[model samples]
Target: MITQLRVDDRLIHGQVALVWTKELNTPGIVVANDNAATNQMVQMTLKMATPTGKKLLIRSIDDAITVFNNPKASDMRLFVLTNSVTDALNIAKAVPNIEGINVANVGRFAENANESTQLSSTIMLTDSELDSLKELATLEVPVFSQVVPSNAQTPITALLKGIK
Candidate 1:
């Protein structure tokens, strides 16, 4: 029952708690990141950041795919968050029914010149990561880069061209 899939390097934070939660009306958040899944401290931090009473499952990508593929999962509105475009693409490939994905925030470390169009002082991208995101668009996932609910989103293709 994934209502929305978001790729944000920040994972769960203020924007997610305040904006996306209400917009999607999701009762649970499934974070698909291998690193975050293994780190107790990161998991604890994200759990704390999530709004009280909402469920949060920090799982590996494989676990997320399994949960997402289950036909019975449609009852709960689930929000899937991934840290990278590659991870997001991987999960989408595994669960083809996911249809669309929203690029919430790429964070500061992964931003690169190719992503300049989506640039905010808070996020950075690497060239390879940008290329990976471009490839993702070819798969027809409709990559959008936006920080919050009010900001205008720039398509990944448009951002790629602006890089050079």
Candidate 2:
């Protein structure tokens, strides 16, 4: 079962390696990103960053669904990580048992400035991103904005209420 579907552009970074995996008690991590799956450098980096003894798999979003829906993996505690909100949404839609989504880091790009709102120094969400998040919330899935397990979680629900 997927403990959480995390959206962090940084993918397998320090926090995810040292913090979330231990906190979630997941033995396996599935990175569902098309670009990362095809990029040798990114794949190598992710493998190196994963904690010792933990298993990490990089696959496209479609392949991730197949893994998650597999009955053989029902005993596995998998933490699904994605590079974008769209990727997380795709996984959530395909996998019925996703517990929730954690929005860790959404970096601001040059073009993103035009339609994005800065929620924090590290978080900038486009209007479309917010809409998708809102849609996820409507499905009764709690969305949290937290950089690491040590940080206090800020529910996207509360932030959206203020933004509206």
Candidate 3:
């Protein structure tokens, strides 16, 4: 079962490695990103950022979804990470056990930042990304933004308010 699907551009970092993982109490951490799965450098950095004793798996988005659907996966608590809302949405649509989605950090490194919509201090989305997020909000699972364990989980619908 997935405790949460976090959308963090940094993938695994201090806030995620130390705070969210411990708070979610998920022993397995899966990074569902095609770029991270094939890039040795990115994979190495993610592995280094992972907390000690926790299991980390880096796989392409499709592969991660397959793992999520495997019967054995339901027996373990997993916290999944994706760099974009679209990827998280894809997982949530395919994996019914996700608890929630945290649209944390995004758009900082996006090439089209000039045309992005600012949802929060930590969240900015381009037009295409914003469309995907809107679709994501319509899913059955809960979707919110909470940068750390202490922050209140702000519903993605609330953030989408007044934005066409």
- Per residue, candidate 1 scores C-alpha lDDT tens digits across 108-156 of 5543545443444533556555666767777756566666668776665
Q: Judged by lDDT relative to the true structure, which candidate is superior, 1 or 3?
A: 3
The lDDT for every candidate, in the order shown, is 0.75, 0.82, 0.93
After best superposition, candidate 2 residue 36: deviation in angstroms?
1.0
Candidate 2 segments whose C-alpha is farther than 4 A from its true place: 109-111
- Sort order, TM-score high to low: 3, 2, 1
lDDT of 2 at 84: 77
Candidate 1 clashes between residue pairs 3 or more apart in a chain or in different chains: 108-123, 108-124, 110-124, 110-125, 110-126, 111-124, 111-125, 111-126, 112-125
> lDDT by residue for model 2 over 28-106, one digit each (tens)?
9999999888999989999999999899999988988998999987778899898777677777777778777888787
Regions of candidate 1 where Cα sits further than 4 Å from its true position: 110-123, 162-164
Give the top-scoring candidate (lDDT): 3
lDDT order of candidates, best first? 3, 2, 1
Give all candidate RMSDs, comma-separated.
Answer: 3.1, 1.8, 0.7
- Superposed Cα deviation of residue 102, candidate 1 (Å): 2.2
Cα lDDT for residue 69, model 1? Answer: 85
User: What TM-score fits each model?
Assistant: 0.83, 0.90, 0.98
Predicted structure 2: clash tally: 0
The stretch of ten residues in a row with the least summed lDDT in candidate 2 is 106-115
